[model samples]
Target: MKLKFLFFAISFLTAIHVFSQNTYVFLGSYNKNKEAESIQVFQLDTLNGKLTKITAAKNVINPSYLTVSPNGKYVYACTETKTPNDGNVSSFEFNPENKSLTFLNKQKSGGENPVYVSVHKSGKWLVNANYTEGSVSVHPLLENGKIDSLAQNFQYSDGSINKERQTRSHVHSAVFSPQFDYLFLPDLGADKIRCYGFDETKKQPLTETKNPFTKTDLEAGPRHFTFHPNQKFGYCIEEMAGAISVYQYENGALQKIQRINTHSDKIKEGFESSDIHISPDGKFLYATNRGKENNIAIFSIDENGLLTNIGYQSTLGKHPRIFALDESGKFLIATNVISGNVIVFKRNQITGLLKKVGKEVKMENVSCVQIKKI
Candidate 1:
C-alpha cells in the first residue's frame, strides 16, 4: 500500500508537467571578463506561460546580445567591445543535452565597438553596428556556423546638431527590413537612418537613384528601431529628443508619419532613449529610456502600422538600456546596466503593462539582453 501511494504521487506530478508544456530560457552574462561566467539559462513556469531552467550556467564571455538563426539551428552572441581583446561576434552550436554552447570560430568585427548583431532573414548574411566608429558591415554566412567572409564595411561621416554626442557619427544599431530588401542604420551622432538597397546576388547595399532612403528629426539622435511585422511601416527611438517616430514604409520607400514624446508633460533634465522593440504579436511596441528616468515607453501599433502612445512604466531598475520579451510574450527581461541586474517583469499582452516578477539576476554593467530557449 505504501509503495503504491508513492508511485501514484509521482505519476500525478509527472502528468501535470506534461500537460503544462515544456519551455526553456537562456540569458546572456556580463562581467569584467575575469573567468567567463557563461550565458545563464533558466526554467520559467507560470499561468501566463511556462518557464524553467533549460541550461545550467555554462561559460561564455560577455554574451551581451543574442540572436538565433531564423531556422533555430544556429545561435549568435556579440561580445560588445571596443578594444581588439573582445570586439568580435561568436557563433555557437547549442546542445540541448547539457544546455552548453559549443565553441565556434570568432569573426572579427572590422569596425570598432560593435554593439548590435543580427542574422539576415535568409540566414545568408550577418551584420554588425559599430557604435563608436560610426560604421556598419555585412558578412557572408557559411554552411557551418562560421562566417564565410565579411563582404562590406561602410562608414558614416555625417554630423548633426547635437554637439556633444554628434562630434562624430555613431552607428548605434543596424537592422534589415522584414523582406530583407533594405537595411536601416540609425546613426545616433548623425541623427539619421540611412537606408540601403539590398541585392542578394551581389551581397551588398547599393546606392541607387531611388536609394539613400534618409529620415531624421532636428538633432533627434535616433538610437534604435524596429519594423512592424506587417512590413507596411517602421518606428524609431530617438535618444537625444526622447521621442518615438512612426513612419509609413510601403512599396520601397519610407515617409514619416508621427514622432511623439516617450515622456509625460513633465520633462526631466537628463533622460536618454536606449532600445526599441516591437512585440512578436505585432500589437505593442516598447522602448527603454535611461538617465534621470529609467522606464519603458509603450505604444499601441494600429492596423495601418501607425503608433498610439499607451504610456510609460518604471523599469524597476536603473539604466534600462536593452531588454527582451520571452518567446511566450509573457515576460520582459529588462537589463539595468548601472544597477548590475536583469529584472524579469510579467507582461500583460492585452493591457500592455509590466509588473516585476521577482528579484533580478545579478550581472555587471550589462548592456543588452537576448532571451533564447533550449
Candidate 2:
C-alpha cells in the first residue's frame, strides 16, 4: 500500500510539470508552388521565451492563414491563390505527443485567393474568406477532424469609394459571433461587415441575416475583427483608413460607437492596418500597423467596452501582418511578413503594454502566428 501511494503521488506531480513546461507555436507562411514548407512548428519555452523549431509541413501551397480547432486536435489552413479563382482549404490531424501533423484532406474553398479560415464553435463547420474574388464559403467538419465538403458559398458585388482598391468585392475575414449564432465577413472592397445566420442543423450552415450587413466608413476597408469577452462589444481594424471601429453588439446587430485612429496624427499618409486582438481578461486591445508604421497600437478597455489609446510598441520588423497573444496572455508574437521575422514581446499585465523579449525567429514570408498550450 505504501509503494502504490508513492507511485500515484509521483504521477500526479509529473503531469502538472509537463503541462506547464511547453507551448506549441505554429506559423503559416506564403510558400508558392511548394518552394518551401508552408507551416513551421516550434516548441516555445514558457520560462525564457525561447522557441525551438520542431518540424515543417511541406507541400501545403500558400497557407497564409491558419486556425487550430478548439479541441487542439486538428489544424485548418487557407491555401492562397496565384491565379484568380483557384484556392483551397486543407486540414491536418495534430498529434500532441510527437508535435507533428498528418495531412487529412483538402477541399475547394469555393472562392479565389482564400485568405482566412476559421472553425465554428461546435467544431462542425469550417469557414473561409477569399480576398481577390470577394467571397465566403462554409464547409462541413467531419467526425474525423477533416473538412468534408463545401456547404455554402456567398459572393459580394459591392464596391467602396476607393476606385483602385475597392474596384469590386474583397472579403478580408470571416469571424463568428461570441455566441456562434451568426458569422461576420468584413469586406475590404465593399467597406461593409456582412452578416450571416448560422444553423448547425442545416446542411447549408449560413443564411443571410435580418440585418444583412453594416456599412463602415466609405473607404475604411474593414479587415479584421475582435469581440470583447463579455460579448457586449466588438472592434474592427480598418486596413485602408488606419483606424479601429468600436461597436455595441447585440444579437446580430452592431451599432458603431466610435472610430479611432490606430496610428498617431504625425504618421498619416501610409496607414496599412493589419490585425486586432483583445487580451484574455478583456482589459486591453492591440492592433498592428504596417506600411510606414511597423508598430502595435495598444488600447485599454473601460467597463463600458470603450477604448482609450495606451501607446505603441515597435515590432522590430517590417510589415507586421499578424500578431497574437498567447493563451495565458503573457506573451505576444508578431509576424512581419515582409521582413521574414517573428518578434516576441512580453506583456505587462497591469498596464497592458508590451516590451520586446529579445527572441526573434526568422522565416520566409511569415504571415500568421498561432500559439497553443500543449
- Model 1 compared with the native: what TM-score? 0.86
Best by TM-score: 2
Tens digit of lDDT per residue, candidate 1, span 1-374? 99999999999999986665544455565554646555655666555434445553344556666777776567777764644544677777766656666667678776777778888887888888887778887888888877766788888777887777798888888888888877888888887887777776785644343747466887788888888877888888898888888888864567888888876658765878888888888999988888888899888888877778888889877888788887778888788878877778888899888888765677677667666543
lDDT of 2 by residue, 1-374 (tens): 99999999999999998766568888998878575878988877766678898877887888899998888888999985545568999998888678688889999998889988998988999999999889999999998998888888988788988989999999999999999999999999999999999988899979777899999998999999989999999899999999999999999999999999999889969879999999999999999999889999999999988889989999999999988888889889999988999988889999998988766999998999888875
Off by over 4 Å in 1: 1-24, 46-61, 84-86, 203-209
lDDT of each: 0.75, 0.90
RMSD in Å for candidate 1, one decimal? Answer: 6.5
**What is the TM-score of candidate 2?**
0.94
* Model 1 lDDT on a 0 to 1 scale: 0.75
